[model samples]
Target: MLSEFKAFVMRGNVLDLAIAVIIGGAFATITKSLTDDVIMPVVGWLFGGFDFSSYFIRLGPIPESYAGSPTNYAALKEAGVPLFGYGEFITVTINFLILAFIIFLLVRYANKAMARFEKDEAPAADPADVVLLREIRDELKAQRGGQ
Candidate 1:
């Protein structure tokens, strides 16, 4: 059983999956930074400086005014407020779309690259000598009434 587990872990598919997961984590961080730090700021600037993260609807027993800005969703939740956090959702959805598209592009390029590598790596055709030998043998057999 241990050997089987080791074999499974060492299989190409498993190794590929592990690498993909690590790469995906890193890609997620990059996309998150792109969205949060770069894209969102541009979006906000275009919309007259509207910060989406701060856009939420309060629903529970909380004052209309909070003394300090909440740093994160947990802080707002801790404030005993039922909230409609649409802005965060929108941001997350945008991030997901961007990540998915980027992955798609990567996969597409990888497939194309793999195809090109396969074409390059394909075994060359049999030598002309081998081909001529086979043809001569066939002709001799035909002449000998071997049909």
Candidate 2:
């Protein structure tokens, strides 16, 4: 059972999937940072605010013990405030789009590369016996013509 498990884990597809997952996680983090740190800030500035993720509508009343500012979305949420955080959603959506676009481009190029490799392959050579037989047949035809 242990050997079977080891064999299953050591399969090429499984190893490839594991590596893809790790790479995908890192890529996702990069996409998230790009969305939050770069794009959102510019978008927020255009919308007349410096912080885009803080643009939320308060749904429920703040707790009596809560001392956070009313405009602080993260702080209010931490203090058990209900919020319609549309800015954060927008950021996440943009991140997903970026990641999906990158993956699509990668897959498209990879398929093109694979197709090129397949098309460039030379046809298989004939076996030694087949080559020898063809040579003998040509020699016999030549001898018959000469006679």
Candidate 3:
């Protein structure tokens, strides 16, 4: 059973999948940073400088001990305030779209590259023994036909 498990884990596909998962996680972090730190801020600036992440509707009253800014979504959420965090959702959605598009492009290019490799490969030449055998067979056929 242990050997079987090891074999399964050691498969080419399994190793490839593991590597893809690791790369995908790192890529997701990059995409998140791009969305949160770059794109969102630019979009906010374009839309009159209102931060999208802070655009949440408060669903419940703030806690008495909550000393943070009332309009702060992260602080309010951390303090157990109920919120309809649509801005955060929008940011996450955008992040997902960006990640998905990047992965799609990678897969598309990878497929194209693979296709090119496959198409460019010529068929293997016949072995020396096979070529000799074919020549002998052709000679035999010629002799028989002549006879």
lDDT of each: 0.87, 0.90, 0.93
Candidate 3 is scored at a TM of 0.83
State the lDDT of candidate 1 residue by residue for 1-147, as single tens digits: 999999999999999999999988998999999999999999999999977877777666565665555545557776667888888889999999999999899989999999999999999999999999999998998999964
Worst lDDT 10-window in candidate 1: 65-74
Instruction: Give candidate 3 regions above 4 Å deviation.
Output: 124-147
Candidate 3: C-alpha RMSD after superposition? 3.7
Stretches of model 1 off by over 4 angstroms after superposition: 63-66, 69-75, 123-133, 145-147
Model 1 lDDT, residue 142, Cα: 93
How does model 2 fare in lDDT? Answer: 0.90
How are the candidates ranked when ordered by lDDT, highest leading? Answer: 3, 2, 1
> Number of clashes in every candidate structure?
0, 0, 0
- Looking at model 2, residue 58 earns an lDDT score of 95
Q: Write the per-residue lDDT of candidate 2 for residues 54-138, one digit (tens) a residue.
A: 7799999999999878998889989989999997787788899989998999999999999989988967789999999999999
Clashing pairs in 3: none
